[model samples]
Target: MDRTSVVEVGGIAQFIREIGPDEGASPPLVVIHGGPDWDHTYLLPGLMPVSLHRHVILFDMRGCGRSTRGLGPDGYQPEFVVEDLSQLIQALGHHTVDLLGFSTGGQVAQLFVESHRRLVRRLILASTTAYAGGDHYLVGWQEYERRLQIRAPRPAWAECRHGEGDRGVRGTVQWALDAAPIAIWDLDRLDEYLALLEGVTFSGEWLGPFREGRLHAWRPTNPEQALRDFVGPILILHGAQDMGFPVQVAQRLHAAVPATSLRVLDQAGHMAHFDQPQAWSSAVLDFLGG
Candidate 1:
């Protein structure tokens, strides 16, 4: 049977939801979520299909979801996150496990794998990028803005320190709502995804810094270059129509990392799991074959 509870790890209470058998499985799959302001809820439904047979472990990072925050932006550093993951795995009595990271979560997984190379068995990077983008960093967003022709100014996270009036979870949700159109590639699925997101509970602790676009979380100095020695299975999944990171970014990442495979799902966007559930899960399941 699946398990659900909160475990205090690395000086914080982390909320965990497990699906499928915990033992006699190949290896538990740990899913790291994205968003400085979001949680793991959006991923649970899409990944449930795979969890039916394999142990699926999902948790809210400190300062997100129901997890208790440590302090503020300083507490949300990448080092602390790596420690949290390491301690959580040990607490669960797992010496090794497969990891699936989506978006910012992928950044976390990559950082963890880079540091604790021996602990992770496989790595799945879905709809994520390595660094914050290089010379072409703002190209995609610029194109999107041009197409949108929005008269209203985009919310600047760095400037909105006040958290858009409500200096709490609601403000973070506001950021989500504002970034939705830029995040989702498939315009038709925007409303449905937004509806699902409405029920998601976000953390207000880090909302201010996150809204300001101040991310001190892990980012690769050179993503592919950093993983030169990594020997584990690496799967790079991207949406063919992704506007945020774009498919080209995925291609470069795939090319840089050795022993990595890339699969681009058509008609998908930044949130491929929501935009193309069947295809997204199928690729993940196939890569994590039992």
Candidate 2:
């Protein structure tokens, strides 16, 4: 059975959800969702399939989702997130777990794995990039723009910036609605992705900075070295058609980190799990092993 509760970690109330058994042979898989603005709900059903094989743990980071909020800029730092995950894991009575982070959450996973290497058994980076300042950074975005022009050509909200006028979760939701063309490769499946966002709580405090280009500010001291030094195996799972991080970025990350195994799902966009749930979950299950 799945359970949901709030745990106080690092002096903040963190909302956590768990699926499958707590004392399974394999360690629990702690998943971190992307969007400093997005909570953990969107990954449901799409990510639920993995619960059949191993326990799944999902939670919202500080200032996002149903967790503690309103701390403003200082509370949103990557260090705070890394620290919270560490404390939360210890509080949950686990010595090790398989870690998966999606999009920006993957970035947080990177930091967490590096800071608490002994706590993570395996690392999965889905639809996320290790470094945002590299020269290859623009590849996915440029492709996304090209695809958007061809697919969504002059959408009604074209003139407005994402989350424009609106603040908090609604603003991010608005941005996601506007960026649907590039978010899901199969235009027909766009509604499936949107359906998951229904009633999601967003943090305007976090969204405010995210909208101002703060998402790119996350730069690990030396990601390649950190991944190389990681104690467990790493998986780079991404969408073949992802315009945000692009397949090329995954390729580059794979080449840099010899320990990483790369999996690219076709007909999927940035939200590969939403687009191809079976393939996405199967890949994760296979990687975790029985």
Candidate 3:
């Protein structure tokens, strides 16, 4: 799994990874990760388990993680991100694929399917939003501090002490770890969960735009208007208590898309797959296989 290849689109290089069996699988699952700034590393274990059932392709959005970085706001446009994935699929020799877009990645997936409807087979929208009417769900420090009350016990905090190293990567990691009680409902593997997130790599460039108010002001021209033409199965997998996007956002998305299966997993938050790995993976497999 160490070997990776870059798929270039519009001269911007995007990183791509593949795992699990390619044969005897439904359409290959292509995953677009979260964080306009986050890389694909934090989605592991939850996603890695799905590989046992089928081939999974995970890619870091341009300017995030191991891909090309330091691209300013203009370069991180939504269309550009969609183009990168478009060419990435072509580069992988896949005509169509089952897609999973988590968090911000889910927004990218929705837009991509709208523009390239025929290239998608099954759609899984996990912990994401439609961002309609130009809504960029940004959380404030006060609210962040409020969210911290849900953080795991002090022992769990010690597991991710590495998060306090530096302002860029470390701070971002600490913030995420601080939101643990919201992330991991089943505190059984708290140490393993923190370690996995701490190990996930990140890029400073993606954060610069967010803090500068550049990325937040941007929105898709037509998130659902374009989707009116796409007549395919969409699985809306969201956390029952997702404070980040709220379950209502997922409800709206499912309502707008005529053909959608909504699965609200109990005891899960914004990161449903992380909170309920077994249930989440099984739900994904059942939907994709159906």
Candidate 4:
């Protein structure tokens, strides 16, 4: 695996990692991380299985993780994030490629497919909502709000009152991780996942931007149109027990996208890849026709 940085739209440098196959490959699969605020680290390990089939490209979105910060106000919006993805794809020299998006990343993926349908070959959406509706779509929003209230008395929270500091956002992210229902998967893997998250460094400058770009803060302009318009093959993987994006959202998405196939992992949650690797990987590989 090799890592490189590329400047996308808005001049935000995105941290991209590539896992090349033994034989040089063409048209690599691009994996976009979720959390608008979270990094790509969590998905890195889960992608090891997919590397055997095709080269994999994983990247952190602008203002998150190792990516450059403060692309200004225009860069903080959801539409801009989709534009950044489009720019990154073009810069990488690929006219079209397979796409895998998890959770919030699915929003960007759908938007990209809608606007640039010809650029997406196959699309895989996991543990995500088709639109911004109810608490199901924004599961962590209330949790973050609750944490902010709890930490209001702290100095770090006080520092966030000025609007640009990351204290509140970082604290809220950590709290959400802590509060997430522990998975019943392999205990060792769960421990490793928790440790990786604990070591992540959140960008202070992305705090406000991340919060402002949340699905709850912005209404879904035309999700149905986007879904119905995209013609590429699509696979929807949902966890039966996912608390963040309810299974209904996945079903709804499958219904909207005429060329979609849906698979529900019985024992999985928001992190389906981690909770059910064998099932999740098999479904993806099958969809990819390997």
Best by lDDT: 2
lDDT for each residue of candidate 1 in 198-237, tens digit (9 for 90 to 100): 5676767766665577657566566676566678989999
Structure candidate 4, residue pairs in collision: none
TM-score of 1: 0.87
Off by over 4 Å in 3: 1-3, 23-25, 132-147, 150-167, 187-189, 216-219
Q: How well does candidate 4 match the true structure in TM-score terms?
A: 0.80
Q: What is the lDDT of candidate 3?
A: 0.74
- Compose the digit string of candidate 2's lDDT tens values, residues 245-285: 77888899999998789999998888898889999999999
The Cα local distance difference test for each model comes to: 0.77, 0.80, 0.74, 0.69
Model 4 RMSD in Å is 5.6
Winner by TM-score between candidate 3 and candidate 2: 2
Please say which candidate is ahead in TM-score: 1 or 4: 1
Per-candidate Cα RMSD to the true structure, in Å, reads 4.3, 3.8, 4.2, 5.6
Tens digit of lDDT per residue, candidate 4, span 176-287?
4554443222334545556556555455454565557642332246876776677878889888867677778888877776678999998777787878777887887888
Best-to-worst order by TM-score is 2, 1, 3, 4
TM-score of each: 0.87, 0.88, 0.83, 0.80
Candidate with the larger lDDT of 1 and 3: 1
Q: Which residue runs does candidate 2 get wrong by more than 4 Å?
A: 133-143, 146-166, 210-217
> Candidate 2: RMSD over Cα atoms?
3.8
Task: List residue ranges in candidate 4 displaced over 4 A.
Answer: 8-10, 22-26, 134-165, 182-190, 204-206, 209-220
